[model samples]
Target: MFIRIVKMGFNPENIDAFLENFEANKAKIRNFEGCQFLELYRDKNNTNQFFTYSYWEDEEALENYRNSNLFKGLWANTKLYFNQKPEAWSVNKIAEAQNKKPAL
Candidate 1:
């Protein structure tokens, strides 16, 4: 599985507008092919700072979604509110939780 995380810092006044866009499009994003999971998070100390954490089947699936019109629209709306460039990370899960379980 591929894990994708994007952290965005927005102007405090624009936070609600950005979240509205996310709420409106989150369902459609989650329904994309090869999408495993999706969620939005906020920094506890800074409400204007938010993040999205998603899981995908692979890089190809992510690329397809990134190139879709849905992404373009959502991203365009989100970017204008940003106070700084977004930070993103793509990761691979190298270990399973079950492997750390105590032996029977």
Candidate 2:
């Protein structure tokens, strides 16, 4: 699995609009193919800063979603509200929680 973390800093004046757009599109984004999970997080100290955490099956699936019409629309609509160039990172899960085994 792949994890993508997008950090966005928005113009203070556009924060409300950004939230509205997120509210409208969040569900659609979560339902996109290869998306196993989607979550939004905000910096408690800075209301204008937010992060989107998403999990995908792989890079190809992520690229497919990024190239889709839904992304185009969302991107265009949100870009104007950004105060800084958004930062994105892709990560891999290297470990998983497992039940402990009894010592022999």
Over 1-104, each residue of candidate 1 has an lDDT whose tens digit, in order, gives 89999999999889989888888889999999989999999999888889999999999999999999999888988999999999999998898765576779
The lDDT of model 2 is 0.96
After the best TM-score superposition of candidate 1, give how far the Cα of residue 22 lies from its true spot, in angstroms: 0.7
**Top-scoring candidate (lDDT):** 2
Off by over 4 Å in 2: 96-104
Which residue pairs in model 2 clash with each other?
none
Give the TM-score comparing model 1 with the true structure, all chains together. Answer: 0.90
Compute the lDDT of residue 17 as modeled in candidate 2.
95
Once model 1 is optimally superposed onto the true structure by TM-score, how far is the C-alpha of residue 62 displaced, in angstroms?
Answer: 0.4
Runs off by more than 4 Å, candidate 1: 96-104
